[model samples]
Each structure stands twice: as C-alpha cells, then as structure tokens.
Target: MLAPLILRGVNFKSGIVQGPLAGYSCAPFRRLVWQHSQPAFCYTEMLPAKQICIEHGAFNRYTSRHPDEVKLCYQLSGCDPKALAEATAIVAAMGADCIDLNVGCPKAKIRKKRHGSALLAYPELLYECLSAMRSATQLPLLAKIRIDGGSNERHNLLVAQAVMAAGVDALVIHGRHWREDYSVPCSWGQVALFKERCKGIPLILNGGISGPKSLHALLHKTGCAHAMVARGSMGRPDWIHYLSGPLEGELGSLSLKQSVRWLKQHLEDLSQLESCETVRLQARSIVPYYAKQLSVDSAHHLVRIIRGSSDFKNLMLSLKKIL
Candidate 1:
C-alpha cells in the first residue's frame, strides 16, 4: 500500500497533497489535480484576506471547489489579524473543510501587500491572527512559513514556538529563507531541525522536493510527518501518483504524446470556464514548464499555443502528429 499521509489536522489516506500554486489552482486546474487518485488533498491558490472578506463573489470564483476534491484547504494571506479572522469565518461558513494561512510565499507583489513571508517579522501578529481564526472557525488551520536562513535560528524558533502555542494544527516550513532565491537549494536539514522543535504538532517539509529521490530523502532527513508538492505537479498532473509509487512499469511516466493530450483536454474543457482570458493565460502559461520534456512536435505545439492560435481542432491536429 502507498504511504497514508496526514498533515496538521487534515488526514489523507492517499498519502499525497497537491501543493497550492498561485495562478495554477483555478477551478479547471484543480479539477485535474483532484481527479488523480494519489493526491488526496488540494488547496486553493492563495487569496488575500481582504479579498476573501469583502469579495464574496470573486472569492467564490477562486475558491468554488469541486465535490470530489477531498479535504480542500483554502489558503489566505494578509497582515491584518482582524481581516484574516473575518476572512476565515466567511470561508468556513461558505464550506471550506480546512484553512491554511500562507506565510511562506516570497513574491514581491505579495510582500508589497504585507502578506506571505513578509509577515515573519511580526510573529506576534501571526500568532494573534491564527488564534483569532481558531476562535472563529471549527475547521482545521495550518500555518505555513519560510525558514529563515540557518543564521536566523533563534528567530525561526521563536516564530515556530509562537505558532505552536497559538493552536495551529500544523506547521509547514519551507526550508528556505525569505532572502534566498529558488536557485539556492532548499535545506531539508533545517526542516528536520524545526521539526525537532515542533515535536508535538505535525510538521510538513516543503521546498525543492520535485522528484522521488528528493522527496524520500527529505522525508527521512526532516522526519516530516507529511510533504507538500508544488511546482512538481504542474503539467504532470499524476505527479502525486508517481510519488506514491514507481511508474516505470505501469504507464512509466507521462509520454510527450500523453502530455499534449492532457493539455488539449484541459483547454477544451476550459472553453466553458467562467473567464476565457484567465483560463487562457493559465493554460497558456503552463506550456513553457513542460516544453523541455516534449518531443519536437510537442514543443512546436507549445509555440503555436503561445502564438494564440489554439482551438480544439488545431490542438488535436498538433497532438495527433505527435501521437
């Protein structure tokens, strides 16, 4: 049997959870992830607390979830504790099975909003915000934070202690500092160290875990109870299944033909998506990520897609040549 994974208070007998990615967790894409049998849980793209609080319709647009999606967690980010609480209450009322407060993203736009990892400097505020949410909702809550460099050990410990004290059911620590770029390798050793400090609460290891070797190694090194996969799952929707078991025998990883076929299916189904441009941008944005794995014909298929000449027939024609 595959590993039965659980994180924070969310349990996944499926052993894997799809990591939330901005611009990727829209309804159509999430549907793809949820359809996979291995990914037992899914998270919405991070929504700002203010937006979730005030923009009910738009929040529903981002968070409208599928019935088949098991243990769906909506991740929210913002600096204000009060607004964060308000947003948590609203989403809990709207039927979020779990809620994750995102403090791990390091994007400039998110930082400018005083959200994501930028709030690390305000551990007190993070505690208050989490505590408020805990008081407001019966749903499970997870706090995600980036591990500051190995240098800020003391600060990281303080932050972790506060989060655990605030009654968060889980702590997801991305083993990288806010200042570090993706080019820098994520240190699983740091995750293990943090896990040691957070012995009682569930600690999930995040960052730089793209393949089986890294995933297994990190799980062993960090002693993490669970792992979250992000960029790894993009075009390879079966990434979670691949992680749960080796694919060298059954399907042996997705072929270039299979990838293109999936993309075509995604786009075809997306025609009925609520917003065409949003769906187009998301579908189109993924081409480059899968470009390298593609065969020659598949690569050109992406080029044509980028050129904005996509239709069901054109896409199928491009894919048929490759198949």
Candidate 2:
C-alpha cells in the first residue's frame, strides 16, 4: 500500500513516516510504535534549539530516545539561524537520522517566539535558518510546513520557494492552514499546489490521514508518495500498520483488552524515561485516547477512574480493572 522512502542516504523500509507529536512523541510512545508498527521513521517532539544547546547533556522527555529507536528525526524549533544550526549539530551528535525544522506549529507561544507558522510570513529569515542548518550537518534536513489557505498561492509558494532555495532534502507539507483547526477538512488542493512547485523534492502529505482509505486518497490526489499520521495513532501504537500494508482483520483502534495491555507497557516505558509526575499526568491523557475503543459509557467510566487516580500504582490498577 506504500512505497519505501529514502531520505538522504538512509533507506526507510516503508514510506509512511510517523509525524512528530508534541508531548506524546517521546521515548516511551516511540518505543511502543517500534514494537507495534515501525514506520519509515519516527520523530521526537519539538525541541527548542536554545534549550538543546543549553542542556545538551541532560536527560529530558524531548531529547531522550529509546535504545530500540533506529531511524529517528530530531525536530527543532527556534527563530535564530545560528541557534538552530547549533542545535542541529547537537542532535546530530546525539545520533539523529534526520533533522526537521518545526515550521508548521501554530500555537500562540510558538508564534510569539517568531518560530513555527510565524516563519511563513518571513520567507527570508526562514531561508537563512534552513540554510544555516543545512550547512551544519550532512544529514537530510526537512522543513515541515503548512499552506496559507485557499486562494493564498502567492504566500504558500514563497515559503516553498524559500525552502527549496535554501537546499532542503524534502518538504513535509500538511494540508491545512495554521489558523485552521483539525475539524476543518484538510485541503488536498493546496497540497497539490506544493507538489507542482516542488520541482523534484520528495513531498510528504500530512493532515487528517487516519487509515488506508485516507492515506491512499491523499497519495492519489496530491501525488505525494509519503504521509504522516498524528492524532490517529494516539494511544493506538498499531495504527500505522493498517496504512503500511494490507490488513486481514478488524481495523482502527485495537480491541479493549489489547489496548489495555498496550497501555500497561506504554506507562511502564514512560516511567523509565520520565519522572513520576510525568507518568501520572501522561496516564490521564493516554487512557482516554486508548479508552476510545470501549463502549461510550465504559470509556467514560475508565477515563474518569484514570483521571482521578493519584499515583503510578493507582493508574496501573485502574487500567487493569478495565479488562
């Protein structure tokens, strides 16, 4: 159902890459993905360039990687080219297979820092940052971006032209504008515009891609060979498998019992990689996502139990009772 993707000189067994999710894309979640559905590559949560440069050796959620991780992309966020360049080299030394610039994040805090979607408006500065990072390492450098909405071709093209001119290896374009929410349908038409201007750079389509139907549709419509999944894979580590190839059984989220088992291991891995407080907090969000497979009343009951749990032991106990 998908083609093998080769970024720079690295060969990904499959072309369906895992998108970088903020808090959830850390070591434990990625470890689960590796054990369940290994995609072309998995991305780490966005790492602030300044933070990386400052705490280069410290172990934290953003910079930590599991021993099982093979093809990993370290995503960096910052406005200064020099700082981004430094951080790129830092991640390279930390063993990154790819370096991605977070140009698509739309959060107000990110925009306030002149990073993320804000960079779309400053094509020259974006070029400078990409150019600097490109020179900093020999790894494949990708810029993850979104369009400027319908009828805003000029702005979208400018950013596309800037990345290409700065000599990026590939373009990972999401189908929605930064201002829009996920409820708004993804605009494959705008992604097609980028495919036309790409010249030859490999374009990876992202946004609203949940399964084989959506994945195949995006590829067929926009002519992109690769796609990334975000919310679809939350708490369901096996979500990527359905898109990687043909499936024989039930689809989407795993059965309730199976999901509860997966969540047990996921929290265990999270405990090893993060603090006790992190495990408590992450369990709250993780349970509800995986609980979606249950009946509505059952799911609500499980989520309520999980959120009210006081500690790691309580969290595990609540999850066990679900099955």
Expressed as tens digits, the lDDT of each residue in 145-240 for candidate 2 is 988765354578889889999999889888788888877788787776677777777888888876687778778877778888877777777788
* Candidate 2: segments with Cα more than 4 A from true spot: 151-153, 247-253, 318-323
Show pairs that collide, candidate 1: none
Clashing pairs in 2: none
State in Å the error of residue 229, model 2.
1.0
lDDT of each: 0.72, 0.83
Give the local distance difference test score of model 2.
Answer: 0.83
- C-alpha RMSD in Å of predicted model 2 compared with the true structure: 2.0
Alpha-carbon RMSD of each model: 3.0, 2.0
